[model samples]
Target: MKRNVILLATAIAAIGSCNEADTSKTPPTNDSSQVKTSTADNKYVNQPLVTHIYTADPSAHVFNGRIYVYPSHDTATGTPENDNGDHFNMMDYHILSMDSVGGKVTDHGVALHIKDIPWAGRQLWAPDAAFANGTYYLYFPVKDKKDVFHIGVATSKTPEGPFKAEKEPIKGSYSIDPCVFKDDNGSYYMYFGGIWGGQLQRWNNNKYDSAAQLRKPAELAILPRVAKLSADMKSFAEPVKEIKIIDSTGKLYKEKDNDKRFFEASWMHKYNGKYYFSYSTGDTHNINYAIGDSPYGPFTYKGLLLAPVEGWTNHHSIIEKDGKWYLFYHDIQLSGKTHLRNVKVTELKYNADGSIQTVHSQK
Candidate 1:
């Protein structure tokens, strides 16, 4: 955590300010959580940013002059694998950080543990971080006693914690993968939800329908959600709205269009005055984006951001530092097992036309 918090806010406020600008990925397409990743492709080996422990579903941000990463701490619990993602038995979170590009990454020991969260039952998945009112807020996903997933918030004076967990989860948060984006106007909007094991398919008519299956293949694919956050960055400031990702023809992506659909992991960034809503197409193994005029969008699909790396799942975050942009993500490169993963980073670029140049390796 840097003392000059205002500069950090300026960097984020600059996201849509200087600009306008910005997926977990899903499980394998074969309807199984087990994925065999190729290591020989060496070109896709973008090298882990930290190798001391396993981490995934990276949510990266700049705080002061440093970068703080909030990611799901992957653990090998040996819980039998299934479509419900039981194999991903992550129990806690450790914050990873760096001082600069190509700099030393520091693992800021346990920030929040499952044992400290009173409402949590099992699984602490992907998380995102934000700075407001001189306090750093960590937004995360965890399952409650009912086995239903919900998002929760924790707070710390520093970017990395020892964070204090709230006694309850956010009232309107359901499903998983929460991304909190701050607008140039100083408003904070949260984008979240995922299907398959991530459970976006389990909610019906805004209520939990444990038996609900995937939406019809011919109908529009499941959409991620967006809602403004309270000024305190603790609860929803408005009703949650669905975020639609349509194609060039204004046609909404259908369930069968798995290649470009929202699977999990929601992130928003502003560059050159455009809002880029990017996400992972679970099971498809790639990260993609859609561009819109506003934060809440019926965005038109652009194209791939990161190609399928050597894994069954993928999650990432993007930020501009020192006038250059970088993508922070994860893969099973360290253990070669789906449940264990490592965080990695690589330079990301945008074309003259404002479309992101698909990245396959570190620049």
Candidate 2:
């Protein structure tokens, strides 16, 4: 494992059906299109989908029978890289898609940019997309003028978007990696938060303290957060709640349990009536998942969904297409630099009993 020295870093849904055309409350977007495309180098499976640009933290979804990817657009580092992940320095987002799994992938040009976001500071990180009431919604995290990270939403009439940002960040939302999961009943829930460079630990009781540090077993590790999104999909309907990821024996993991505790990259999927919550173990360099009966979980830790790859950090999304499951994730394969990554996909198999087999993307 190419694990970076474990730094006492800061901390950091559902298979609902698509009601994508339900945009009664959302105003129509009229932004001029600047869509672009790049031919994918897909001579092999499980390879980087594109090399024209660095993409990571893939949030993959199938909309209207087409595969759509919303990922963090990584730029060449202008700042020094550190445990705080400062070099990531992302400024925009590009949407990717294809007709079929092994078919040609197209890079839909900048869907959203830092400059377009009214309250955004810089470093637009991982984003996830959802379809609701006649629109495609892009949920993302960016630092505000105060340099405090907050989640925000952008809208598009189509999946491959020239998405338009709302005037402000989602109120009361802090941290990074916003994953929206829709339940079978048509309700939308959001899961988010990250520590360290993600600035999750700096917030407490819905307030932010620039000097707040992880206080060990007292605060434990920074915990991931969840909230129910209002019908419009732009704000939280309820208060943010912390998720408890405990071991199989029902023991809640402590901060030092590095590999098993939650770090960042929150994802939720529903399978056979059970909810699967997965995440990236940042400092330890692995992707892990836990099983929960509800979207807001006290989930029981399962095992690795993916072992450490060549990259220092990885974020992923899962989709079920044609009855088969696939994992969309990123690693530092194209640039060989942690911040500059390439997104890839691989088969994800579940055991008869419902556990996922660990994937070694490097293999």
lDDT of each: 0.79, 0.79
lDDT of 1 at 48: 67
lDDT of each residue in 60-120, candidate 1, tens digit only: 9999989888999876677998878888878878887777656656777778989999999
Worst 10 residues of 1 by lDDT: 1-10
lDDT of 2 by residue, 1-363 (tens): 254222111111021111112223223222212111232322223566665567799999999998898998887656897877878888888788877566667777778889999999988999999999899999999989988889999999999889999999999999999999999999899999887788988888778899888648534666799999998999999989989898878877878888877889999999999999999878887889999998888889999887777678889999998888988887665566777777877778889999998876532
| Cα TM-score of candidate 1 | 0.87
In model 2, state the lDDT of residue 216.
86
Off by over 4 Å in 1: 1-45
Task: Estimate candidate 2's alpha-carbon lDDT, on a 0 to 1 scale.
Answer: 0.79
Error of 2 at 356 (Å): 0.5
Task: Tell me how far the alpha carbon of residue 134 in candidate 1 is from the true structure, in angstroms, after superposition.
Answer: 1.1
TM-score of each: 0.87, 0.87
lDDT of 2 at 85: 81
